[model samples]
Target: MLMSGSVSLYTDKASLYDVDYLSKDYAVEATFLQQLICNAIQYSPAEKPHLLDVACGTGNHLQFLQEMFVCTGIDLNSSMLAIAKQKIPQAIFQQADMTNFDLAEKFDVIICLFSSLYYLLDTALITRTLQMFVRHLTSNGMIIIEPWLTPDKYEEGKCAVQANQTANVSLTRLSVSRRQRDVALIDMYYTVYDGKNVTSFQDTHAFLLLPHTVLQGIFDSLGYATEVIMKAPFQERGLIVAKAK
Candidate 1:
């Protein structure tokens, strides 16, 4: 299980995650991501790319990426990986930290999406992880990331409530964000009513508000050409694609 950072939310409660993002269009996001990878890989080409998904929470993106590429996913949360494995049985899923993992293989495309990098919360670890991403690339590989909010984009005291239900189960999560210096501290309360039973839990996630320049600087220093694409499925955020030079 993830011992710290934003992964904490999924550590024990992977089942709740799908319900949390029930409104998100992962298929559409995956389509956009495929286009992003398509444009970024002109410098290097692969007929059938081997894609590594870092912090793949529930294989939502990989579900679609697997249709187009050979997919492998890694996440710190075992519970999350369980759901991911069940979804993409054809793909490989492993439990590993973003900063420290050795698959002993390289991929043509590496992706860490849905603001996953913000969970690193440490500059050194972030750089180290990006270095690992570079190391795991096939020299022609491209990296795509969806970032968390920057300082200017982050607003404190924002609250979001999401609820989803099926015939047997109902899940609801109340989330609120607060600022702690460069960190966004989010507190989540989840309630699950499974017809015959009721359970409730609280999870807190802390995400780093790393600036775009700082992120791009690490990519640039690693001999990557970084660009921030203004278009994305999420209106509140954008995608960052960095290609090997």
Candidate 2:
């Protein structure tokens, strides 16, 4: 059971991040993104396309994406970036914020996955982040995002729990969903057993319930072509794929 305490997942708990999400099928998600890129940039007889992952925590996707593209990842958390850099030394890793980052170079594809966009907390920031991504994209570049649950699909007051363990570490996550207007507040409690000791902490994650219609409008207003694919990695979470008009 989790007790009353708070810890930074981006800092002291960063090493356990991978253990918490050990079951996530990064390979399948990478394959899906690869297919999308292939279809979008068909027959490009140039060097390998450049790919930028914004708010790319720990570079899980980059591990596989690097095989097809020149991968670059940026995250605001230095700890996460450190882990990512150690994992994929061949790829570029930087500490950056998604809303206002300038890489001074263009990418053939820019991705923000794992619903990281929701951390922006509002429609305006979402738009600002998209614009920033657009600025760093090549002429025909595309942006792919795995969005958080939309307003219509969000189930308020829901409880969810997950447990995972390895040879030396055990992790259990219990989360409850609540809402404050457009933001979905997930109160998460985590308890870990590392064979020798036990520890527990709590964290609250607020994600803006970005509606698909609003997302489409934002893309339309920005003069971009967009599509919302409902059948994405997390099923109901959906995906937003966009390209400059």
Candidate 3:
């Protein structure tokens, strides 16, 4: 659930989320996801596989995935979920936390993409989240996660910037990354200019940077047959594909 008593970090600019990721190849990624599901699990065309997307921000992936599977998307941010609902009106969108959610239905494939798993911030939380996923999975279901930057790949004091524009709005986002022990911290500043007004906001995001060995160990401990694709298509963060052993 969205944390109460305080405004969520994403509340102000949820509408701009899609504009920020305009260059992402969601269609290609969705194709890759479809292939991964087909190859990883056994299913028939007559019965389309059901898929649940955890932390499905703005439904960008689901927009393309709905064509391939029966899709349901969940996100903790209401603002993000609203945008997703607007974009993919035909599909189901719900407000739910990744660590704990009960939809009362099972799925053939459950995917946590865009490095969302890192938000759990610790191995115990990550493990509990995966356990929840397993409970909601079918006998032959698969769990796919796109992990965050590993320890070896993380670069401290790195600064990145992006600028985007629409007919009525122009925006710039600046990000500076740092490391704190096993966690990676990214502080982001956004400056947006509308035709008549300008505004600025700042947000900090933290992720528990898990190494391949640690992540693989978690899967192994849970009795899953897992594969880690080092050269994943989109983020280069590598992808984890796992099935019940």
Candidate 4:
């Protein structure tokens, strides 16, 4: 059986999460976001902006978000946060749920990347999470959400393989995901070989396959200045950019 919806694949794989995701071209992503911010606000923040990355995972994006904004990361997994802390000790990290969290400070930019929002799994949870993002943003802040695949875009029983090797450690991941009704049911198998030892584990993840119109409706109902950019990373799943009304 799949575990609770709150389960994170990174709970045990935090060490390698950085090695995998951090290697992506984050500078390009950063540049894109910067342009979005400029186009949205028509000016750069006068001072270093405070950025909050919801469901930040292993803080791969933080390395670039921190370049233009002071960065803070929040994730559901403590192990992930621990690894993120070590990787970017200068930034702040917290273990917090995206659907509900309280931060004393508001952020100039809030982001949830890599289809993490779909983990909310239902309209109620997703709405509450959108409220959380709005509540945490400054007066002029923008929220950038990278959505997951819609039902039509999702491939059933899709499989992918990834492997990385270093002098002391070798790691491999095999993932397969299929739609279970309105959710994407994913099974990920990971194996790590550290020369002297070997370990393996599996994690199951669930993502809500929300329709595009429904997501846009949420933004419209919230009365935000909303725009969906078609040219985004990751198979052009699209990006949702919103600002408070």
Q: Highest TM-score, which number?
A: 2
How many clashes (backbone atoms < 3 Å, residues ≥3 apart in a chain or on different chains) does model 1 have?
A: 0
- Between candidates 1 and 3, name the one with more favorable TM-score: 3
The whole-model lDDT of each prediction reads: 0.86, 0.88, 0.86, 0.81
- lDDT by residue (tens digit), candidate 2, 79-150: 999999999999999999899999999999999998898898878888999889888988888999888888
TM-score of 2: 0.95
Mark the regions of model 1 whose C-alpha exceeds 4 Å error after superposition.
Answer: 1-8, 42-46
Tens digits of per-residue lDDT for model 1 on 1-245? 11233334586667778877888899999998888777766532446789999999999999999988899999998999999999999999999999999999999899998899888898899999999999999888889888898989888899999899877779888899999889998898777787777877778888999888999999999999888877758557787889877
Candidate 4, residues 60-161: lDDT per residue as tens digits? 788777777789999999998887788789999999999889988898889898889998889888988888888888888899998988888889888998
- How well does each candidate superpose onto the true structure, as a TM-score? 0.92, 0.95, 0.93, 0.90
Is 1 or 4 the stronger prediction by lDDT? 1
Q: Which should have the higher lDDT, number 1 or number 2?
A: 2
lDDT of 2 at 85: 96
Give the candidate order by descending TM-score: 2, 3, 1, 4
Better of 3 and 4 by lDDT: 3
